[model samples]
Target: MRPTLLAVSHGTSDATGASAIAELVALVDRALPDVDVQAAFVDVQQPDAADAVPAIEGPVVIVPLLLSSGFHVHHDLHGIAAKKTDAVVADPLGPDPRLADVLAERLAAVPGDGQPAASTSPVILAVAGSRDPRSLTDAEGMAHLLEQRLGRPIELAYLAARKPDLRTTLTAHPDAPIATYLLARGFFFDLATRLAPGRALTLPLLDNGPVPSALVDLIVDRYEAAEANVI
Candidate 1:
């Protein structure tokens, strides 16, 4: 039997954010019909990993739907996997070039200051910051990928829990567009909108329109790579 793909996320209370994440899981389910795909949350939602992991029958691959490694991935998910017999945790979905492509598309879709964001124009990559140092490193790595993709300088800013917050970054750049580095709409995205008042801000990676193919592929790759070592 195929191992269960336990797609875990940092759950959100926002209805749209919840739906967006569910849709991504559904997309992955369709992509791998033979494998069982289950959704679970680390916080703020039901069917959590603690509950879901024990219920699966076969080997499991726990794939974090988060953008970076942090408290949730290290303490929360790993702790759960450590207790299981044939479960493995996969890497977070970010710090990849495909995500940079999605970020670039989002920037292109929105005009900056009545004009397109120029390739040379400085852009801020706004991430939902974390206190963990590894999370910070991953955020910076993502910024570098996006910078190379956009052919522009990228400034890494946090929404909360870190310095150089979004509001402060906006003040510093004044005219640079903010590329939303979040996976979906949630408290952080709402906070970003409230802070940016009249500025260019791109939508999160997964939006209401449709799930990005890159995201689905990335998740599947994570599961497959980890599944290989599940014995």
Candidate 2:
């Protein structure tokens, strides 16, 4: 039998956020029709990842739907895999150039004449900040990738839990548009919109629009890589 692909996300309370993640899982499920794709969360929803892992019967590849390495990746997910036989944790989805391509596309498509053109306006890659240093590095790496894609310097800012918050970044570059680095619409996305009133804020990585093919491919790559390492 094929090893299970356990797609884990950070979880969100917002209904749209939840739906987008569900859609992402559905996309991945379709991508690998033979594999059993399962969904679980680290917080703000159920079934919790801790419970989901133990219930699975065979080899499992725990692929984080998250964007970077942080407390959940370094502690929570890895800890669960350490205790479970035939289970291996995969790298998070981000810091990849493909994701930078998505961000660039989103920035280009920002509508309304009220917002500055993506070409003219400075772009700030706004992330859901984490206290973990590793998480911060991943966020910066993503910013660099986006910078390369846009062919312009990209500023990095946090929504919470770290320095250089969104408002501060805006205060410095008042006309900058935020390229939302979040997976979906959630508290931090909401906060980003609220903080930047009347400013051009790009949609989250996963939105009401069709799931990015690049993202779907990235998840499958993570699963295949981790499953290979499972022994």
RMSD of 2: 1.7
RMSD, one per candidate, in order: 1.3, 1.7
| Steric overlap count per candidate | 0, 0
The estimated TM-scores of all candidates read 0.97, 0.96
Q: What is the C-alpha lDDT of each candidate?
A: 0.92, 0.91
lDDT of 2 at 17: 94
Compared with the true structure, what per-residue lDDT tens digits does model 2 show for residues 87-131? 999999989999999998888777652343645556888999889
How well does model 2 score by local distance difference test?
A: 0.91
Point out where model 2 deviates above 4 Å.
112-121
- TM-score for predicted model 1 compared with the true structure: 0.97
Q: Give the TM-score of candidate 2.
A: 0.96
Candidate 1 lDDT, 14-77, residue by residue in tens = 9999999999999999999999999999999999899999888879999999999899999999
